[model samples]
Target chain A: MRNLVVLWMLILSMSIMAQMRDFQVITPELTGTLRLGLIRQNESLWLSDYKKIAAKKNGTETIYTIKHEWLNKGSIRISTKPLLDTHGFVMKIETTDIPASIHLFWAFGGCLGEVINLTGDENSLKPEFCKDNVFSIEGNSFTVYYGTSRKLRILEALVPPDSDVRLSDAHQQQTPLSFFNSGKKNDAPALAALTPLKNNEAVYFCFYKQNPKADYNYFMLPELYKKGSYEVHSETQWMKSTPD
Target chain B: MFKPLLIICFALFVGMYIKAATYNVKDFGAKANGKNIDSPAINAAILEAEKNGGGTIYIPAGEYLCYSIRLKSNITIYLESGATIVAAFPGAGKDEGYDAAEPNPDNPYQDFGHSHWQNSLMWAIGEKNITICGSGLIYGKGLTREESRLPGVGNKAIAFKECHNITLRDISMLRCGHFAVIATGVDNLTITNVRVDTNRDGFDIDCCRNVRITDCSINTPWDDAIVLKSSYGLRYFKDTQNVTISGCYVSGFDNGTAYTAQWETDEPQAPDHGFTVGRIKFGTESSGGFKNIAITNCIFERCRGLALEVVDGGHMEDLVISNITMRDIVNAPIFLRLGARQRSPKSTPIGAMRRININNINVYNADSQYSCIISGIPGHCIEDVSFSNINIYFKGGFTEEDGKRVVPENETVYPEPWMFGTIPASGFYVRHARKILFDNVRFHFAEKDKRPLFIFDDVEKSDISNIRVNGIKVENPFTAH
Candidate 1:
């Protein structure tokens, strides 16, 4: 009986591990890097050429910093620092010498499942429509909840905002959002549109996931946190905690 | 370890056997947020599907901001209910507009907008077997309505060039910059159950073949609701053939009120704009000519009437129009102009216009000034035209002085119903036509007008029978010059 029980547990654990992966987002999953527009112009950057990436692990926590620089044209520099826990991570972004509206787009690969809106309302945890403050995704067997420290704007696709497709002045029409490759819908990756970074400024966002088995309680948390201010509870403590 | 390996192998086998996969744009990073530009992610998902032979690219419900979306072969862009693709606002800077129209040497042959496909919010060129279908909305908010000869604005909601086997169904378009849809040199096209409410021209099928437009409701205040053209823009003289437009409803509303349906029940009448335009037409651009066409079962409300023009040195023949109902027509209910604008190359002389038939047409409240005209140039008379079972009501208020007015022969000018000003006749005017026939035709007016029912100027080989004026039989209604 003891041997049978050990074998059963081993199979169950293996299956569970296969079903639910540890919050390890490989390099490709987070393919987006920081971009700095020196002249405040609209141009896409190659993520590999401009990124400086580093990561450190301490106990059960990991810290990552990614900085990018553009030396010529406008001499722009931008950086993203993320503190990752088992559930998810929190990131702080800083930029310098951005002359005009500069955009940074990122994708969390396949980690986030089917997306549902978080209509912050009084009946639920968050009562307001935070531009894009909170959302939910379906996990392997349950719904997982995610919340951001700030109201992040989400985009269905990454198309340059100012591109025009009008060829003639007949009737003098203007098409502002033109496609680079026509007829291929949404060829660019889906990403979040961050608020434009100024010459010297930083914005903070916290991304934390909640298992639906645990009622979504973090909706009541405030947006915008300091560097290293968001702390994740240890596994032993989280396992024993009750609903707030 | 052996068990894990077995499981992995099984998974790989299953993955390999899957015939085609459904790719959600969300998986590729499309945020359905109302304001984000979603064209890139949606395009990426389509390309991914194309890479895998061909699959469905599914778009869930949300407002997706998009620019131009390139379409590939063997793909269907499926939009879930309540999904919308909105045009983004023109931000600062000139390059921020749509990709500049590709410079083609044939551009001088046609207007700037008709010469290229790149200057549209959604466009396909030289593609095959593509479809955009859903019970969704495409709102062209920030697209430009400016008519220009330059390449710096977006003018069309959807444009196609040299494409094949395209289908657009069950979609609604609102405020579609200039033309809601324009297909040039496209073959095997099907557009059904679509609605277009716009301020400018609706659908323009130019130099296309095998087109079927059915069960559509179009309201445009500024221009023609549906038009067929064969312009020299395609560089080659490809005749438009095998077209059937039926079971459709067309009308005009105020400049910006087509989508709101305000013209139906409420809203004060804005006749200054709506009454002047909005009708079905075939060519002001008849360079390549038209053939094998049938238009039937159409209704026109509160707009201009039907017009057929073969002015740009192209043949207009073998056309059959039937079962048309029109109300509140601000101009002549039926106007056919076959002129010698001579928009042909030096080697090509003017072409012929003949063999046209119109039947089962009813018009009410037609404008009083210009009667329905069938006109051709002095020497080149239109040939073999027939009209049957037609009834028209004119807004009678003309005096004897109006009856004596002689319509001019504006041969080379733009072809419009009102281009000749007031005509001498109150009902039908046939000028420079041969072998003309009218049967079971009735003309009436709300008030008494002392004008002839039919005036023929240089007409030849005509037959007129069974005509009525104000419910009374009139004998010899024809007055020939």
Candidate 2:
């Protein structure tokens, strides 16, 4: 019994130690460095480029951004925009934290490659792809980063409860199909009013929708943020917290 | 005996061809009286004839006063030469529920109130195939300018709503107070060969469809000489579709601000443009949209704002505006503002303006301000825009040094010298647009502008070709800062 108790404590300590990862974000030049703020589900948080990924927090809202990173660090990429095969989801984010980096990962049903965003936020990134590919995107966050592995930059582990799609992941996600892609619009105005924020009221905004019309899709971004960038203000985040 | 029989038969045939009835205002011992002739008499005559199987209600040569009158199917209200129908005075309703339908009521419109309507001296409701054609005069007693000063309400004129397949031709309407003649939610209507003179809007159309207003001369002071609107009323409405306003001459105190220059109605101080659109938004009262709208071969002279607006209402799609000629405009020669404000608290419809096409537009001698502007929401651009053989000018161009103007003589711009306000955008200004294309565009300035005429705010996937400014190819306006 004594031996078992000691063994359990040792195992617990080992798991905790593994969580203390050497999560350093480095430029390809091995020059710029940034400390990452992370809470991990796995080793998904330790990326090589901080500019390629960023976090934005607005009290209850939190956004995660990942750039359309690919190819060698500091090298131009002619790759397609990031997308998924099962349910192709993409987003773009704009930020300045990245020095130089590109993150690309592969799990494929085919080869359309990833959606690459050259610049800015709020994009419906569509890239030509062939057969099958599985991907996820930050949707509307754009930031600067530098690296060479072109490894995957997963955002789910970083985003808060309600993160908006990044520019790199523009069209929600392409599953076997996308309904709104048909474009047979609605007649009655759906709504897209932007009441200006009074200087004193509040900066953070929130919207909740359930089943959007089959023919229409909507996206909302603050005036100040860049594509693929949650660096300014986190736009939207979905939390799994209890109602209480 | 055979000849006698033939003559009797011929007489019977002639009797069959005679008009069913001939009732005149004079037949009732009615005189012009210079006062508004009660329209009930004429209406009674018309209804009587209809009951007797539909005929003509002749308005002979005389000066007559009149108020609202309705016509049914298969009826003709003919005005002979020298006849005149003077409009009833505007009803006075310091209160909200005053019906413009009845003439003599409490606080009658001698002239005052915005809540009032111009139910046309000769009006009709929800019926079909009616015609009002004549060479006589119809006097719509406009407010005497004193009417505009009334605190809340005041618009005197003739207007119609929800009547269809009607034609109004060869008449002269004078000094209308509100809208000289207004029509809404009606279809298959045509107005031709009419001359309207007024301080109010010459003709106003809203949420109406299949209308044609051609070969008319409209002169007004307030808004569009002939304006089409999609407004938010008691219901969010699409007051227009498939309308053709061609071969007409229009001019206002300023350029018409119909959907083009001004589409937002946040200001509560004024009636907005009689020529403006979307002052109200799409919602509650609405569950549909507007499609296939065209404006071609029209002339807008010295107007305030020109062009169609697919504002922030829910959705305005498939618009084709072309072959437009504008001269001496005060503000923008062409403007498209596509945004809506959900002013109502109800389950108001939202924005969805899409699939638009604007081509073959020409503008000249607009004021020193900007000439053309186009903007869309962030996700949706003013898409597939192609300007072919287009020519626009800002008349007098501003200099970059205008920002540095010495104002050697003391003008505001010259003194402070940071003239940020001197140059207003350009011939083409795209904001938050996607997939836009520009072909064969010519933006001209008075020889001295050193900068390119195209200014893009935030655009993507855009292609430009055959574009010239001051007869020179477009210089790159984008540079690394």
Candidate 3:
């Protein structure tokens, strides 16, 4: 009976999930780019939206950065050119500074939005940013005409930005290392014949792109006989003569 | 004379009492046409039988291409051998003043859309004790030459919305141009021994509870073979709880590399994802996520990525996967990833509390490009995952560099093409996970492969024990495929 009730509640909540709420995407920013001195000399690849309530990756939110915290709602507006590639008052921030309530403001829509061009006149920030609960941004550093003069946005957290954090070799030296690579050619015959390779349980395929230009980003797919994921089964303890 | 008449009347009364009441569509004169037919005559026959309180309405075998036929409570539509219900074209029979939907307290299905609401083959609403049995077939010939490409036209074989105690057995649903069979927002539904061959998803059970699917065969052209969806109506993630899929054979969805086209188009159209289970939508609706589904005793072949996924912001809990087998898959054997780092549900307070247990499985041959990917949010880790007693085979192997190990493709063939995408891995990889355990697991590859058997990123509280790796084949005696 209790299981039935729980299931009924689960079904009820699913209908609730289908119910919509009030939200909007208001801010945006594009951070870094593969710039070239040769052809068009593109300044940056737009990555994040400063106008959006949220930021992407490990970025800042619109609430913490505009010198004030602000909530977003539906029906937002976009300016033709924000910041300066610079001709007019392209950016204006109603809220000029980060607010006290916010923890971390996401950048771009979520990634850290880098506001580059503050031409002599044009601005992305609106004047009544804090009073009207909005912050418009404009930059002069790159070509942003290809982007939305204004686009929808989603607000996230307003976390302070930090540099990339890759782990140091503190544990690498202490931990034991294992390797399992089963590419083609190491067919079933080779796998069975290879000595000193038996009973080597647990396999992980580490996929890393040497550079950003690389297309291969190795991700996991499911297989019946491949036994791709590592697990500890509690129900079935009987061992079969399966090779790992 | 009077005494004789009384005996005759008594005998007639006894016969009427003994025989169960039955009504046939032929009694009311019904015809089955591929086009130009009314579903009401057959529906009326089913209802009259139910009004007489529970009986069977038999569909004689022939091609009856008709629009939505609403069902009633306490009824069983028995498809006598060779009965086939072909899906009628959408907007075909709406010319006259025909009213399809009217609200009724006795029927809660009225709150939901019509079965023909989107041009489905057979749809039922708010029905109870409904059983569709016998060796019949429902065909949605969406791939036909006379088909029209109209928007809002959904071609599904059978759709049951807000129904209860529904069972469909010994049936074949084929060539549903879009979705083959979908039972959404209903309860106590069981589908068994049904073979579905379709151009789209074979079977989809979304946003319901106590659903069981067993001993079924699903052959699909794209996306999941037997998919369990947690959300509906382009809304936020909805929790699809207590789903069990066992003893099923699945194949196909071998279309490769989804990044071949642009993400968005300027036209106003339904979002396209013949392959996506959950997606980020422009919020017109949202509530909770999905959780507590179990999939066991299944077989897979020629698939693309992880058959099980927690990609969208749906709530997932207690996902138990065991006794599985696989062979000749295109991509990694398992891919459990949160969407783009920024698009992860963490920032939006949408938690996908995922837990996976994969045990007693064998994977024969895996040839994947960029095999396994795990990219999830940091703080809201994909928690409580376990993989034990497993064996995997990656056909090719790798070699050790000056001090670093490198995959074979990194040096020769692939060389990391900027445009074509990257090459995948030969073994286990996890990211942003917590309470993860790996015991008695083996990853076997030859000595010529490059990649780590285990890689962790932004993970908290992980234990890897009883692990064995092959193809190390070095002098150190620590490495050996």
Per-residue lDDT of candidate 3, residues A211-233 (tens digit): 11111111111121133221322
Tell me which of candidates 1 and 3 scores higher on lDDT. Answer: 1
Candidate 1 per-residue C-alpha lDDT over A1-244 given as tens digits, one digit per residue, 9 for 90 to 100: 1110100111221112111111221121221111211112445443323334344433323333334443223332222223222233333445545446555432221222223332222111111211111111111011111122121122111122222211111111011112121221121211123244554555433333333221111211122123323233232121221110
Per-residue lDDT of candidate 3, residues B234-293 (tens digit): 223345678788898665532111112222211111112112221111111112345677
TM-score of chain B of each: 0.92, 0.75, 0.74
The candidate scoring highest on TM-score is 1
lDDT tens digits, residue span B51-167, model 1 = 987777888899988877778888888878889888765443544545556656655445556776787888888988988889888888767553322333466889999999999
Worst 10 residues of 3 chain B by lDDT: B410-419
Per-structure clash totals for the candidates: 59, 115, 161
TM-score of A-chain in each prediction?
Answer: 0.36, 0.18, 0.14
Q: Rate the local accuracy (lDDT) of all candidates.
A: 0.63, 0.43, 0.42
Candidate 3 TM-score, C-alpha based? 0.52
Interface RMSD over true interface Cα atoms for each candidate: 27.4, 28.2, 26.3
lDDT score of residue B33 within candidate 3: 55
Global lDDT for candidate 3?
0.42
